[model samples]
Target: MELAISIIVGFMILGAIYAIHARDILSAVIAGGIVGYSLVICFLLLKAPDLAIVQIVVETITLIIMVAVVLDSSRVEAYGKFDRPAWVTAGTAVLILAILFWFLKEASAPLAPFGENSMRMADAYVNGAVEKTGSINLVTGVVFDFRGYDTLGEATVLVTAVLGVLTILRIKGKR
Candidate 1:
């Protein structure tokens, strides 16, 4: 399971890199979707079904919005030009790689093994959720009652992103 998760994470990183470096806008958008789907898989592997579902839905909507934007744009694809010198770019990449490697190495040591459910917060939520929020479903209660503001903020952000994308596409249509 750990190996599977590691492979998925590797693919996620690859997708992110591809999205950033892709010459074509359409390819970049597709790569971004790949990264988002990979995250959903990661959430499932971590035993968070609710998070996985939410991620899948968000990813699907994001992909649709991005594709709509791309299709409505005048250019089918656009390539970005790097103005920095090759050596400077290479040095920056190397530095970033080194920092990432160090951080991964330090963070890879697991605090708890898989299937371990010893968290105090989990116990508290499981025990008190129903009484506190008057909801039979603990997850739903926690999300809607305990952390309702956070959920609302997330929804707001999603709506803002969709509106921004629609505004850009609409402005492009005028031109």
Candidate 2:
């Protein structure tokens, strides 16, 4: 799993660099979207499905809006030279990302194997969720009752992202 994540991170870095160095706005946006969607895969690999779901939703919306805006605009920019300082900055970013990845790997070293549940809370949720939450569905109870605020937070993030994009796309005179 770690190996897979490392490979994905490599691609993620490449995508970000391509996004930065891309000459055209549309290509840059597409490359940026690659970086984002790659993150969703990383989240899933790390056993964080909730985070992956939210990330994919937000990334898809962002990618669509950016592509539409780039296509709609008539702006053109001359290709810019990649100076030594810019290269240094990119290198620094890569170093930071690498360090973070190392930290993530170390953090997960003690965790149980993939597909195994090591969480103490899982036992509690499974045993008493139905009676306590008054929900016939265990999944529903866990999401809405035991972890209500977390679920709300995820929903809020999705809604806020959508609304922000809509606001930016809306016409000045339109409500």
Candidate 3:
């Protein structure tokens, strides 16, 4: 698992560099998608299935949209040489990643390992309120019953994105 995660991270870093340095818009979009996919794999390896699922779905959609935009652009440039100043892009990305990893490490370092207590509560919820909530899955019970508002907000954001994209497409066609 660790080796897999390390490989994913290496790919992500390389993809970031390619995204910044590759002059072709389509290549840059693909590189960005690579980074997004890497992050999704990393999240899954870290045992965060829910986050991984959300990340994969959202990132895939985002990448598709970006690729569509790049395809629609009139100017199609060849993939150029790595022309960006390497130091600037690499340093900034590394610094940002380091800070983000540091913060997550600190945040998770103090978390208690899951044990019987969590299981017992989950079982209790399942046995007690599963039918009442009309949710056969305990995870759904927790998400909809406990975090429904957050889900609502996420749906709102998705709706907003669709509207924005439609508006932009319309404007693009007119001009």
Candidate 4:
């Protein structure tokens, strides 16, 4: 499982690098989509099914919108010359990598062992959600009663994104 996760992380890093270094806007957008999907896979591997589902849906919508935008825009490749020395950039990147490695080493402890439910919040919700929220379905009670605002915020963001895409498409049609 660890090896699989490592391979996924490697692919994600490769996707990010491809996105950043891609000469064509369409290629970069596709690479970015790959990275986003890789993140969804990572969430699933971590046993967060809800997060994985949300990420997959959001990523799909975002990728579609981005592809539309890319198709509508000019495809000029702009390469900016770096002012800083290559060694300086390399050193900075290495330092950042080292910091990330150290942080991951220290903070990589699992919140709970694999397949174990050890979260206090989970326990609380499982035990009290029905009683407090008066809902027979604990998941529904927790989502609608306990975290309704958070869900609303997510819905609002999705609606806003759709509106933005519609507005952009309308402007493009006018041209």
Scored by TM-score, the top model is 1
* Candidates by TM-score, descending order: 1, 4, 3, 2
Question: Which pairs clash (backbone N, Cα, C closer than 3 Å) in model 3?
Answer: none
Evaluation by lDDT, superior candidate among 1 and 3: 1
User: 143 in model 1: Cα distance from truth in Å?
Assistant: 1.7
* Runs off by more than 4 Å, candidate 1: 74-84, 96-119, 152-175
Clash count list over all predictions: 0, 0, 0, 0
**Candidate 1 lDDT by residue in tens digits, 118-150:** 577887778767779998877899888888999
lDDT of 4 by residue, 1-175 (tens): 7788889999999999999888899999999998999999888998778789889999999899889989999766888878999999999999999999999887868666555767778777787666699988675787788899999999999999999979986784633
State model 3's lDDT. Answer: 0.81
For candidate 3, give the lDDT of residue 98.
Answer: 100
Root-mean-square deviation (CA) per prediction: 4.0, 5.6, 5.8, 4.4
Model 3: ten consecutive residues of lowest lDDT: 113-122
> What's the lDDT for all of these models?
0.86, 0.87, 0.81, 0.86
Q: List residue ranges in candidate 2 displaced over 4 A.
A: 43-58, 74-127, 134-143, 149-175
Superior candidate under lDDT, 1 versus 2: 2
